[model samples]
Target chain A: MHIPDNFLSSPVWASLDALAVPAVAVVSRKAQKSTDSNRLPLLGVMGAFVFAAQMINFPVGMGTSGHLVGGTLLACLLGPWAGALVVTAILVIQALVFQDGGVLALGANVINMALMGVLCGYLPALALFRTRWKWYGVFLGGTCSVLASGILALAELALSGIRMPVALLEASLGLFAVNAILEGAITVSVLRAIERLNPSAVREEVVRSGRATWSKVIAALAGVSVVLTAAGVLVASTLPDGLEQVANKLGMPFGKHPAFRSPISGYQINSLGGAWFSRAAAGLLGLFLIYVVCALGGHLLGRMRRSYL
Target chain B: MRYIFREGNTQDGVIQQLDARVKLVLLIAFILSIALLARPSAVQLAVCLCVLAAIAAAARLAVIQVLRRALLVVPFVGFFSLVVFLSGDGQRAWSILAKSYLSALTVAIVISTTAFPRLVAAARFFRVPAFLVEVMQLIYRYLFVLAAEARVMQTAFAARGGSTGRRALEASAGIIAVLFSRSYEKAAMVYQAMCGRGFSGTLSRAEWRPLRVSDIAILSAGLLLATVVHFISI
Candidate 1:
């Protein structure tokens, strides 16, 4: 999910960086006001924990391996604001220090993996946990969060001008689906173990329930506004993304070459009238995607907190 | 590896002499310049290479150490660069590959020459908040401890004959759980310890001076070169 440098346009990348600022600001304010001093250290430790978790990859089919995005888990353990902060920090450090992801792609990577992954997975989990069917919520929360995150991740790749064949998307999604289910199982097992070992510790340590109810909605709206504004600006302008425009100017569009055209090429809804509307719609949908998925991530985290609390 | 981040051994010669701020600005400019170089001319590449060499020399970083650390990056960049040619850009593709390598190399050089603590201090001087600076500090400290824990997990898994296939997955999962729980517990202990010692939200720093005029002059020179090249390429 960590998109590397060199593949994306500067505008798109810059736009993501711009979008991150407000969400970060909102979250930072929420975290500070909560006065949960315990949560601060948790942010640092959880960053390390997620960093470590990322290193231990499980075998996926076709001789490749996948690791946990853990966005949802972080959101569940911490609230969304802190969770986003923690995940973003981990991603930045991993890229800059560990050389794991591309530097330019950090913006998209955080937007997709951290923001989208945490919220989407959290929302459903919280809703489900409130019901009698805890396990069902766990399964659905984990699955949908991953599903949404995967879709958004794929879109990011596409927007960066890397064409994914339909077959490839299907295969990748299928693999991720398996990965998410197993991850879900692991999440459930870990939660159960933690519950058994020290229920009180989980209750005392986690910070999800503290998230103000109004924040959930505000974050969603803010995230959507950012995505739409960014996409609308890009679509309206004549400039292509940094890499794509560069490729075109160089007469070498790489993945944009005919052989690599995707079914959803351009991120535009062609059926819509006017280029602006099409792009605006795409931007709106993209933001919607990030909001829904990330909100779910927060939801899942909230549910976990309630269970222990 | 051990020398890269140990404290108080500021015997790194010229690198230690330069203001940390100067190094930070130059490193960032270097990365941006390289990234923006669409298809670098050989002259452009030569200019960058020469500057890199000069910086390396000034920092007194051993060529061997730089090369050793830089080699780990070869596999990652090598595989992707090879694909660049296959994308049908011909000569232009080769140029892109070279530019990317030099950019990555520039990043490597900056990190290698500067000590981590100084780098963090530099970041602070750059106005990165105290909270984030401390967070970065703690993460680095905990990384070693976590690595040791990871090693122990591997050893225990091997001893239990849990070294293959399904067992491997389970072992990995178990290790993750353990690390999560242990880190949480340790964090609680750390918070308690800090509280006992009157821990506040902000971490205090010892006295340090700002960048001197000479440091500013050097950074300005680097920036000037970058700006010239940027407009020329444009």
Candidate 2:
């Protein structure tokens, strides 16, 4: 799911943006090192394939349609590094050209759909490849990748201090779970088709039997799961359980603290008494603020860097 | 697939006339300021909206286009916002919805005003890796070609009584596989073409233009405005 701007607080999106740059750099570097020639064109064509694939929506049951997110599929076909890079490029184009996600939130979007999605998908596929259930890796990878992305997005929103009821979070999770299954089925069908048509296209030297790599991949996947679980716990603990008192106990300053009181402080408009209107207004104000601040910061940073050079 | 080509309306207004680098800076500044604010006041939101409107007008962008593009993010964000509302934090839910729309609008303005090639050139100026930039350009160039192929394939499928269902999905998967193989061949041909023309490992860089004094002035003014908005309490 492409997170729109203003859904995430500045700290959330900013840190994600920071993390994504280096992650993408590393991916690009790895991808460059692996291929000898025509790498650029290869990535370009793959990216186009992804973009075009996303446009062709298929009818899932219940009169709903879903398109391929392509993270797992790309990783399966191109390996993880090149796969992530291609997805990142597609995301960039979607944001800048299609306005699919927020420009400022590009970092988070890339991290969610490109980096984490690829890793989650690729690692599982790698581990499963050694087993009798080799083909099942595609299905598992596709499902896991989407689920991981959804959880990460929720975790980010929680970390940003946006509290929603447990029910709401569960609802979102449920939706993603279903979407993940569909994605998994699609990935499997597509991969199988590719294999049947041209086995070499889906074949890679790395997927061949190697014990050491399998252990490492499994370990990495375990580590990611552990970290995600811990993050979920952290999010759960912070929910409105005497939040104000906890902040006070922690010596966190609260209430009318800043010189500039946000027009909508605490997600409530002061003058408006109705809960919905105040909340909506507060939401609107929070969004506007984020849009202004991130845009400004990115601009100043770009300018300063240029001047310094 | 409705591909969004750059409008090339760089001759229309002050925003369009500004150097691509300067326009990028201004857009970033506006986006950064929005992101930095912990909670923007209603006044601040209004001010930002006004500023966006002013920029759109200056750039000669159609308001309807900007609005339509910005609305694309609503369903995604709106779903979560609805959940938040159901959970009783109506304020945060509304805030998410509003903020996402404004952010989308701000980005739309940037893309509409600046030509896509110039924007890509600006990214190159920022020292984004040459490989990444080259890949992006190639993807943009071939996106339409592949998309057209996909469209033709889908049309042919539908003509053969391919209604939406499980069978359609299976058929679509086959189409995708075929597309991947076709695109792979196309990539090889493209590499061959590049090689034929004395293909160096790197694509040729675009000509760089030094930032003019006027461009610097505009950037500074934009930054100054952002700073003023940031510090303003209301």
Candidate 3:
């Protein structure tokens, strides 16, 4: 889901843009480091291939057809960093040339699709590479990539003071689920077909055996993040006040502290003046805080282990 | 001759004649200002839209065409707005819809006015990564070629017969796989061609021309106007 401009509040879009630029830069650096020469045109052509992949339709038994989203496919073909880079490029082209998304919302789009989507897609497949359930990994990766990004998009909308009705929220989630399943199925089948046509074309990293411990950890972490993201969306949007009450009851001095004394301190941006401004603010801060803590801990532990070894 | 995306690059106009860097800074600053507007009623939104329309006219673009083209953002923004409206928050829904429309229109006008390459140059000048910009250049250059090939393949599939159930799935995969290998081969050829022609990982370009005094004046004037409108709306 490419979000348009003005869909996100100023703080929401601005912070996301802040998050995305660094993330994209780091991923771009990783991609560049992996390639000796600037094999940029190859990545660019693969990006075009992805755009083209969207044109061809895969029929899914109900007389309906679905096109490839290509996030997982690109991740499997190129490495994750390059895959994310390619998707980021596609989002840029879409925003500027195709008018498919908004320039202001570019950061949110990049975060949801390019970074999270690729990481989710890659982790599952990487985890299951040596197993008989390798195809299952591929399938799950495709599904998770779409689902993670879709849910994150929903959360972002919620954070922007979009009060989705229960029925509408459930319907959007259901649609995401269906699309995720279709993406998973498509990725698996396409992966199998590639192996059949040219065994050598698949990257050696996926083919060769790697340490399963790290993969499993990453895969589990990814799974947890997706679940947390979903829960975060629900809490932030629906039970935002309830959450605020809990924070208050826990003696959280959010307002008095000068550091925490920002515009959105009460989980509401005073300037925006939306009814649910506080609702979204509470959700983003509280739910996303948990995610940040967990993610940072895991990253530190991994670094420690790597350094010691 | 003009295309929707590559149009203003080949044409001449008042906005198009302004240096791309100036246009880039001004437009982005204006969009950010539009986003940061505290509360937008009919007057504020109308003013934003009118300003964009005036820019389109100044650029000699078809004003109606630019306005209508920007409506492409409507369906996506409309759905969420509908949700907010249903939940009985009318103001937030309207605010989002209007602001997003203004932002999209601003982008549409700028892109339709400036060449994509020149815009990229401006982005680079602002310190965007070189590698990322290069990839964008290649993708834009060849997006149509591969997309056309995919269209042809889909047509051939339809011409023979579109299958349902199982066979269709495998056929689709086969098509993607073929496209993948073909793209891979083409990339190899492109890299070789670039190398043969002394492309050492960077596309050659003339050095940036010094910004004209007029460009600076236009930029400052635009920024001041946007800031005024923004504060007035608030």
Model 2 CAPRI rating: acceptable
For candidate 3 chain A, the 10 contiguous residues with the lowest summed lDDT are A254-263
Candidate 3 displacement at residue A263 in angstroms: 8.5
Which candidate model has the greater TM-score, 2 or 3? 3
True-vs-predicted CA distance for residue B13, candidate 1, Å: 2.5
Say which candidate scores most in TM-score. Answer: 3
Residue-level lDDT for B214 in candidate 2: 79
lDDT of 2 by residue, B1-234 (tens): 444434535567878878887877777767666655556677777787788888787778776666676676687778878866876776667766676677777777877777676787788776555577777888888998999999999899888988767788999899999998899899999999989997777778888678888788889988777656655565
TM-score of 1: 0.74
Docking class of 3: medium
Residue-wise C-alpha lDDT for candidate 3, range A157-276, written one tens digit per residue: 776666677678888899989999999998988778888877766656465434666755865686567658655756656764533554476677533221234345534546666433
What TM-score against the true chain A does chain A of each candidate get?
A: 0.64, 0.74, 0.78
Candidate 3 residues lying further than 4 Å off, grouped into runs, are: A61-63, A212-223, A226-230, A249-309, B1-10, B231-234
Per-residue lDDT of B36-82 in model 1, one digit per residue for the tens?
55556777777776777676667676655554554555566655445
lDDT of 3 by residue, B193-222 (tens): 889999886787526788888888889888
Worst 10 residues of 3 chain B by lDDT: B1-10
Worst 10 residues of 2 chain A by lDDT: A255-264
Residue-by-residue lDDT tens digits, candidate 1, A1-309: 455566554435545654664455455555555646766676777777776666666654466666666766766666556676777777666665666566656667777767766776666656556458765665565665666556665555455444444455567668767878866765665555556655654444233463437766675565456445433333322233544554565676465432234343554678875543444345445534544554565557558867997
